[model samples]
Target: MSGLRRKLLIITVLLAAVMELIDTTIVNVALSHMSGNLGATLEDTTWVITSYAIANVIIIPLTSFLTTKLGRRNYYIGSIILFVVCSFMCGSSTTIWTLVFFRFLQGLGGGALLSVSQAVIFELFPKEKQGVASAIFGIGVFIGPTIGPTMGGIITENYSWPLIFYINIPIGIMAATSCYFLLTEPVIKTKVQNVDWTGIALLAIGIGSLQTVLERGQTEDWFATGYITLLTVTAIIALTAFILWELHIEHPVVNLRVFKSKTLSVAAILTFITGIGMFTSIFLTPVIAQRLLGFTPTQTGLLLLPGAIIAILGLMVSGKLLQRGVSPLIIITAGFFCFIFFNWNMFRMDLDTSAYTITLNLIFRALGMAFLTVPLTMLAISSLAPKDIPQGASLNNMMRQLGGSFGISIVNTYSARRVASHRVDLISHITNNNPLTIDRINSYTAYFMLKGIAWDNARLKAMGMIDAAVVKQSTLLSYTDAYFMIGILFAVTLPLLLFVVGGPKITAPKVIVSDH
Candidate 1:
């Protein structure tokens, strides 16, 4: 391929991948707008997010199979077209369920965007320059989720919610068109000997059930809800069977044998852990900014913008270092510590934190992620045969999505319980006999009285204010605890690097095709 065509294809796949990832969190800010506009309760509207996530995890592992069934060029373009059409359908839906169904379809298309794009990008460059490819793609991976909320906030606050989905239409078309003109099928194509229908069924049921449980568990009060409990059991049984059955099968839909590679195995686990920190931090920062500190959606988005921007350079630097044969372990270790530092800084944050401080703190996160993305991608697939790259990419991406889901669920439940515990502990000290408590209440009452309220009514208002303060303080404490725990989690996971056998050897992928 000529330099120009290669660049265009690179741009095309990266754009599609970024679009897919953006949708992952973009709908978050618009859920309320969607709920009110569609006349559905907030709970029902949440399926818009859940359905997309479910579709993503389910389809991700299937991308390798799908690519074999359909040629790479055909599969890539088809997925783009499918995504574009579903984006339109999602925007046009008048009902929440309708929107959710289309969102699921959109996710089905979007899943391939991430995994396939990674494979294609790696195929674009030679082994020695593979780090550059990783860096290029890393920019999208890091920036996509980072800017998602920022873009979502801008659109939700300034424009209609449907515009979020609609905006994808032009980008999707451009990507599809470019791929049609420039993308090529692999010179050596691999075929599935037979369709593993049973493996497919097990995979769908198991992964789908597990993803659903993770997405909805907190909202439904975890296993306390009957459906959540049932799904939890179903997920365990189905997943165990799926794993065993895949290993037993001749042609598995997902190649279970790839986990035999120690590098891939360790990389998968590390990716999941990274996903927890990455996605959870994104979740935590915006919540604290908006809920406690009273930042506008745009303002919260802006707070994250600088870190993401600075990380672009960090990604390039890390990729260059890898190209120079820096041990993947060293780079990843440095990344881990950067993120732990980020967690520590955020743990110290209070309601009085400035946007500048948050942005500076997030730069650590951005750099941490920048360091991880390239090495992890290189490490995961470094030992795999050329043909197995797609499968490895699929598994790696699926782990990330799952990790984010689990992280968000765990954090939500933890924060809720912590808030309750802290509130109770706080309330215990707010007795009438406590002089400081009495003085605080009296001060509130006098403030209300100055507004011309009756003494008894003012006193009642004062009590309500005190209760609100307790709730707010408890919420702050709970988030700080979350930050502390997350940091500890990162610290604990660092030792896993010792298990990585050797530095990654990024070889040129033979699976990518030359221009026709």
Candidate 2:
């Protein structure tokens, strides 16, 4: 392949990957608009996001099987076409159900975009330039979600909510068309195996249920809801059965055999830990800024932009270090320490803190992630054979998403509990007999009276204001506690790094022969 064409293919696929990734978080900011426009309750409109996530989690591990059954080029192009069409359908839907259905389809298509796009990118580069290849791909994986809210906010504020879905139409079409003409199929040979229909069903039920429990657990109050409890049981049973079933079968929808590799095994563990931090930070920081610091969605996204650029630079620099023979282990360890620092700094943030200060802390996170993302991903499949890399890659991708799901669930549950606990601890000190409490209540009463309220009304209003203040301060304390806990969580996982040993980076021969 010519250098120019190869770069174009890379760009084409990266665009598609970013588009898919962006959709995962883009709808978060537009939920209110969607609820109003679709004539649905806010609670019902959450399906727009949850349905998509369910589809993504279910289809992801199955990509290797699908790619093999369908040719790589065919599967890639078809997924793009599906994604583009689904985007149009999603945008045009009037009801929440219609939108959710199309979003689910979009998720199905989007999973392939992520799992297979990286496979193609890896195959395109030579063994020697794999680091550079990973650097480019890592940008989309790490930055796409960060940018989505920014883009969504800009569009939502200026245009209608549907535009969020419509925006993907052109980009998806461009990527699909380009891949059809420019992308070559990588020639990985394997014998035709019988379809594991039973395995497929088990996996879908298991992973789909698991994702639902995670996505809705907090909303439904965890195991309290009947369905949540049922789904939890189903997920555990189905997943255990799926694992046993796959190991026993001649053909499995998702090949668990990939985990047999020590390198991949260790790398997957590291990737999971990394995913928790990577995703939880993205989830927490945005909420903290908007909810506590009073930044708009657009402002929150912009706050992340500088850190993102630093991350890109970090990715490039780390990739170069790998090419120049720096030990990946050393780079990864340094990244963890940097990440720890970022989390620690975030833990210190208060309502009075400036955006600039937070931005500086986030830059540390970006740089650390850049160092970690490529190296861990490269390590995951480095020791696998050419043919197994696809399965390896898919498994690693699935783990990252799984880790993200777990991270979001954990953070939400923890923050909510902390806020409630803090509120109780704070409110307990308030009593009619306490001198400071009485004086504070009097001050609020005097202020309310100045607003022309009756004495009794002012006193009532004063107590209400005190309650609001308590909630606000407790909320802030909860977020800070989450941040501090995040740093500690990542730090505790540092011992897992010991299992990661050096290996020759896997590089496939020219599996892709140019058709032209």
Name the top TM-score candidate. 1
TM-score computed on alpha carbons, candidate 2: 0.92
Best by lDDT: 1
Prediction RMSDs, each to the true structure: 2.9, 3.2
Over the stretch 1-516, how does candidate 2's per-residue lDDT look in tens digits? Answer: 887787788889888999998998787667767888889986678678667767877788899989888877899989999999999999999999999999999999999999898988888866666665677778889888767777776787678778889989889888988998898777675655898999989988997888778767877999889999999999999999999999988788888988999889988988888877887787777667766677776777777788877887787778777776677778889899998999899888878889899889989988888888888888887888999998999999888877776776677668878999999999999998899999999999999899999999999999998998899889888888887887898799887777764565432122122323
Off by over 4 Å in 2: 32-47, 93-98, 505-516
> Residue 46: error of model 2 in Å?
5.1
